[model samples]
Target: MDLNIFREYDIRGRVGPQLNEATVATISRALGTFFAANGAKRIAVGYDARESSPIFAEIMHRELNASGCDVVSIGMVPTPVLYHTVYTADVDGGVMITGSHNPADHNGFKICLGKGTLFGEQIREIRDIALAAEFAQGSGTIEHRNVLNAYCLDVVSNVKMGERKLKVVVDAGNGMGGVTAVPVYQVLGVDLIELFTKPDSTFPNHHPDPTVEENLEHLIQAVTEFEADLGIAFDGDGDRIGVVDEKGRIIWGDELMVLFARAVLRERPGATIIGEVKCSQRLYDDIEKHGGRKIMWKAGHSLIKAKMKETEAALAGEMSGHIFFADRYFGFDDATYAGARVLEILSKSSEPFSSLLADLPETHSTPELRVDCPDETKFKVVERVSDAFARTHEVITIDGARIVFEHGWGLVRASNTQPMLVLRFEADTADHLDEIRDEVEAKVAALIAATAA
Candidate 1:
């Protein structure tokens, strides 16, 4: 089996080549062995809307059961619902079969051990175990449970909307988000304008990823045409969110965190709020200004979640829209719950959604840019870039290279899931934003070329 599928945060790769029946069975057996050794007896399993997901899920169920794990089949649900089951159901561990914003031809697994997802060395350990192939043996059983309704109800219960009903636009991009989130919005009495609510593995409307601005065109148009309160879009498995304001202006993840952090701070003074290094500096500033402790940590949902628990943070979020709220809910990243929280904030206020951040300092930034780089060499390229900047400039090397400039900041990090280099830049002015981004991109390109040579 191709071991590269064992990523830093989860197991993921293209369907036919890197993942198939044999590979899936081997991964399942490996996971079962790992979980059993870790004292996990009952395992919750769920798959996303991808065509290959059900097949893989079945393989996992059979393999896990054969390996002495009683499998709780949660059926086809979003990634977050699988996570919800891990906490709500009587299970010792959970596995979500999802590619999570990748193209339709790809699929992967998000493994949850105990209450948290594994990352870094934990993922490497699983890969090592898979290579060793010392199988654990036993006969286990499989039980099916439909938890979508219960999950929706739980989300609805957490949101206390005001008397002002909301007219909202949602673009699910034909992924798993609409399957679960639509019901919650209807129950909340939202005047919902939905696009692509059906679960199609083909992703007929567009790719399910909302982080890329191009993927949100339909959402932006619908929100503007409807003049709705706001627009929300979810990634393939519904773990991440992308939002637009009433005027159809896209509100990036850092901006969303600003709203969430302020509300959380009001309820729990001095609460800790964690933002990844990719987040805008304004988010950290806002957290501190609102009497909440601010923490800037590494990216990736599993890494951020671990940090949140370590610091006992009330809230944590990524620039990629993985928002976690531990203040009044589970700390795991759930776009459905995050959407409800956004509506709750809007319901209580008479101001337009865009106005919520009107008082903050203005800045210009770019959406995350993914540049192709081989997984084997991406880290070295980033290290070289970091070293070059560190010689004469201030740089934060916690995750990759976050070079601090006088006017703004630029980041270059190797993606944990895909073989790519992720880049982002922000500055107080548009001109500075261009300057910073150009400078950083040029340096990155040179390093990548040098590495290739």
Candidate 2:
């Protein structure tokens, strides 16, 4: 088995060779043993709308039950619902069968031990146990509990809509997000325009990742055609979000966080806000301007969630749209919940979505650029890059190397989920953006070539 599927954040890889039935069964048993060892008497199991997800979830249920942990089966739901179940249900831990925003042929597991998802060393521990094959066996039971309705109700209760009703467009991209978001929007009395709401494992229409600009083509078009207030798109498994404003311009996650953070600071001044390294500088500055403390963090949902808990952050977000709100709701990354919160803020405003943050100084930036690199060497390359940059340039090595330039910044981080080095650059002008990006990209390329040689 390709154990590299055991990633920093979750176990994810191509389904057939890396995640076949036998391999999945073994991983399930390992998780079962780990959970039982960690004092988890009951575990929650859930799956997304992927072809292999249901079968994989069944394997987890069977193996976990055998390990003497009672299973709470929250079947065929989004990843956020699994997180919600972990919070609300009596279960001590949870496992989600989801590929997230990856390709259709990929599948994986997101594990939770307590309220938070596991990451880094925690994930490696599961891998070690699985490799050792020291299986724990016992007789346990599996019970079905559908938390979709409860989750929706919780989100609706937390969000207070303003006087104005909204006309919104949603592109679910045939993933499981629609399963939860559709009902929530309907209950909130939104004039909803749905796109690809059906759960299709094949993802026939488009890939379910809203992070990719190409994946959001339909959403942007639909928003424009409907002349909606805004457009919301959910990634596969429904944890991340992508949005387009009323003008059909994509509103990246950092900008979205600015809006959310400002709204939060207005009521709860001096609240702590967390943004990842990839976020815009304006986000942090805005937080400070609004009497909020800002923290720049690593770039993974599991890591961000843990940081939120540790710091008691009022709100946290990443460029990938994993927004967590601890203000009036449980601090977990839920796209549906975040969508409602954004809608609530927009409903109260007389300004359009496009103009909500016009006051923030504009800067030229690149969307996340991913360069293919081998998993084993990706971190080493980033380290070399960091070391080289630190000699002359000021750098922030919190999660990766974020070299602070004169007018803007550049970041190089190994993706926790994939075998790629994620890069982004921002600057005061388009020419400066290009100059910074070119320098950083050239350095990264040379390092990768050196590593290979």
Q: List per-prediction Cα lDDT, in the order shown.
A: 0.93, 0.92
TM-score winner? 2
Q: What is the per-residue lDDT of model 1 for residues 104-216, given as tens digits with 9 covering 90 to 100?
A: 99999999999999887878888888899898999899999999988998899988898788999999999999987899999998999999988999998899989888999
Poorest stretch of ten by lDDT in candidate 1: 120-129
lDDT of 2 by residue, 241-326 (tens): 99999989999999999999999999999999999999999999999999999999988888898999999999999998899999
What TM-score fits each model?
A: 0.96, 0.97
Cα deviation at 303, candidate 1, in Å, is: 0.3
Model 1 stretches astray by more than 4 angstroms: 451-453
Candidate 2: which stretches are off by over 4 Å? none
Q: Write down the RMSD of candidate 1 (Cα, Å).
A: 1.5
| Candidate 1: residue 58 Cα off by (Å) | 1.4
